[model samples]
Target: MNRITTAIAVLVLSTAAGCGTSRSATGGAREGNGTVTGIITLADEVGPKTGDFCAGLDVRVTPTGAPEEALGNRTVRVSRGRCSYQIANLPSGGEQLAFTVKPSPAWQCGNGATPTLAPEPQALQLKDYQTETRDFRVSCTAPSAETSTSTSTP
Candidate 1:
């Protein structure tokens, strides 16, 4: 072969070899691999004059259908009304998992009544090692049957 032709062939082969390898979450798996992380935020309420119940809330996560005895151990702090969490080492597939978070309880509303309760026990679904981030809103008002009695003389 001519020297020019040989040089061109070498360059082509070198470039092709480098192009094949790619960096992905699962080391370039067909479905891919990566970590999933998310943050939870709350929207301020303005109706009924209820106090901020979600501020400094505590969130708990537990794997459902695991076992009866293994409940309420893992917890995520949502202080300042925000929380962030992550799920790692996921495989490739359309798999779904359910998790629940118990937000810190609020005490009272503006009318000297019980504070409203937010939504509890949230569910999450994941697919094909998908890295997803989502937010949840709490809407349930605190039950009036329970009220706080804090008396202080001014």
Candidate 2:
């Protein structure tokens, strides 16, 4: 029964995703811009060490060649060590777009230690009428002694 219910829920979501391409009175879709869903995970090397804190990441998306007045909001915050970013109401013909990931201020090992961070920003282009997913690995350095040492006594 649970499996059946899960399957039904998935079907509904997929169906809605396929058909939800119109503007509405609510804040979902205002145009035919399709949705993009994905999970942002900690780089393999940066995980457990950094506690796999997803909230420590920042994301932003912007359409290229957009008029200054046409600027729109595309920033998303990671929740529960993951993120599901969706850029809606995007103009269909917009050729290029920008995606950026900025690690949060707390993305550290603590104790004034600066965790190694990704060297460069990850960017992605936009494709209309498509669902897209992209994964990025941020480079990071090992935590300093002060931050890496455990306080528990043996």
Q: How many clashing pairs per prediction, in order?
A: 8, 3
TM-score of each: 0.38, 0.45
Best prediction by lDDT:
2
Stretch of 10 with least lDDT, candidate 2: 66-75
Candidate 2 Cα misplacement greater than 4 A, ranges: 1-32, 43-53, 65-81, 110-123, 142-154
In the range 5-32, model 1's lDDT, one tens digit per residue, is: 9999999999898787655433433232
Model 1 is weakest, by summed lDDT over 10 consecutive residues, at 66-75
Q: Candidate 2: what lDDT? A: 0.52
Q: Could you report the Cα RMSD, in angstroms, for every candidate shown?
A: 10.4, 12.6
